[model samples]
Target: MGLLDNLKARLAPAKGKVSHLAHEHGHKVTHGLDRAAKAVDEKTKGKYSDRIHTGTDKAKGAVDRLAHKDEPPAGGGDTFTPPRTPPPAS
Candidate 1:
């Protein structure tokens, strides 16, 4: 009945459709991310390996969540998993 509710109702279907599309195209998204990371790493000659890898992993995990959101995720959705942080240097 309210403006926000009405807008949400109208866009709900669109949201689901987009999620489905993302799920279907997950592989391509993944490949693109990898390629970009490799290129960046090569340009930087492995100087940023740890940071780049962490970022790439987080990005891939986000894609996985978006793609598998409609159905039960391998670990289920909205589980609030923590991001991977680097270990403290000895």
Candidate 2:
């Protein structure tokens, strides 16, 4: 096997463990992130509110994505739907 493939194979179990932990502790992680962000923002006297909020949002999104990595995508299996047009008023 190639070096990269070997590395991936070795790390597969670790990745699974991480995914499981993230799924189980996702809510607590999110709550901790919120609390940390609030504390940091307060310490900085809101000078970095926008950046803090953005970072917190990205971190939460990452956690959510990781926690749901094994789940199928919403609307099911790579399906796409085009937006429907509204009917004109009579």
For each of the candidates, the C-alpha root-mean-square deviation to the true structure, in angstroms, is 12.2, 5.5
Q: Please give the range of 10 consecutive residues that has the lowest summed lDDT in model 2.
A: 69-78
Best by lDDT: 2
Q: List the residue pairs that clash in candidate 1.
A: none
Provide the lowest-lDDT 10-residue window in model 1.
69-78
- Specify the highest-TM-score model's number: 2
lDDT of each: 0.86, 0.91
- Residue 15 of candidate 1: its Cα lDDT? 82
Report clashes for each candidate as comma-separated counts. 0, 0
Using all chains and alpha carbons, the TM-scores for the candidates as numbered come to: 0.61, 0.71
User: Per-residue lDDT for 1-90 in model 2, tens only?
Assistant: 999999999999898788789999999999999999999999999999999999999999888888886578776977777769876889
Q: After superposition, how far is residue 86 of candidate 2 from its true place, in Å?
A: 22
Off by over 4 Å in 2: 1-3, 73-90
Error of 1 at 38 (Å): 0.1
- Backbone clash pairs for candidate 2 read none
